[model samples]
Target: MDEDNIQDDIRIYTERRWLRFSSGSYFPVYVLLAASYLLILIYFTIGLFKVFPCGPDTRQWEYFYGKCYYFSLETASWMQAKARCEEKLSQLVVINNTAEQNFIQTRTRNDRYWMGLTDRDREGTWRWVDGSDYNTGFMHWKPGEPNNDGHGEDCAHVWGNGEWNDVYCTYFCYYICEKPLPIRIKGHHNRALSVP
Candidate 1:
């Protein structure tokens, strides 16, 4: 071939090669990178679940809705019950919904049980021990109840009929403990990240 023709062909080839690089020819590379990251995310998510459990491993505790519950037949005053739950690395049950309330009520229908609810911080303004608001979600207080009757009732409890009432903090009663889980696996910056 002539020198000029050869030179023109080379320039055209180089331009086409540059266009290929800057155009959709690299779509596979982009797709591949995205797939790799997505796979990584999936792996870590599944690994987190497999590496840790939703609740403590024991027969006494029942797992429900990412929480663990323990019912105590032994009775104690409201304050003592609260402390007891904390001692076991849990807190008094906070019924967040009708389903959860039903669950605890079914278990404690035979006797009164202290719950993690009280207006002790401010009278007439109840709140759960775990910082959950009292008035935000499901609450099963009896009609005309929490009048702070008598000397004043600052604690909450479930009755035999599954209704709720406020009684004196010193009142002794059975108690239920609750612990929400996917517990921290330790060694991370306080974030619930799974490492495997």
Candidate 2:
């Protein structure tokens, strides 16, 4: 019957489409979706494995550019300030670019603060406490500054306007500390953090 022929044609068309999709177009689409999902999951998982999660001890610290910073409340000698930061599992702040310098200037606007630069090891050869090269890093020294005045100025401090000047390391001054972000290990714990 013509009706039966038409029915058979419809069934054949459906079968052709289903077979094409299942064996051809649909398989590539499924593989592409799975690959995309795997890449996305890996990207996020790498972040977790690389950075330590922020915690209580740094509850009062400022966050910038994926790092935590602590601006000291009291003044201390450069060495003392360095030791204090070490106690907190951090190092004295190292400004690496204009953006970082500007960020700290927002806090240093009206007060002098100790940074991590010192030329004590070799005069006129500035170095960051973290061992980063100063010659290749950012510098915002005040005009005619870092003169190593009185032949004993080996430490660097930021002025209210954010320019740097060489000073005696023994001078007590406000300081900044930069907390290092390391991968979190199982069973690792910092001091009890108090949230406000």
Candidate 1 global TM-score = 0.64
Alpha carbon lDDT at 66, candidate 2: 61
RMSD of each: 11.5, 10.1
Report lDDT (CA) for all predictions.
0.81, 0.83
Q: lDDT value for candidate 2?
A: 0.83
State the lDDT of candidate 2 residue by residue for 164-186, as single tens digits: 98999999999999865434455
- C-alpha RMSD (angstroms) for model 2: 10.1
Global Cα lDDT for candidate 1? 0.81
lDDT of 1 by residue, 71-125 (tens): 9979999999999998877889988888888888788866999999999988989
| Candidate 2 Cα misplacement greater than 4 A, ranges | 1-53, 182-196
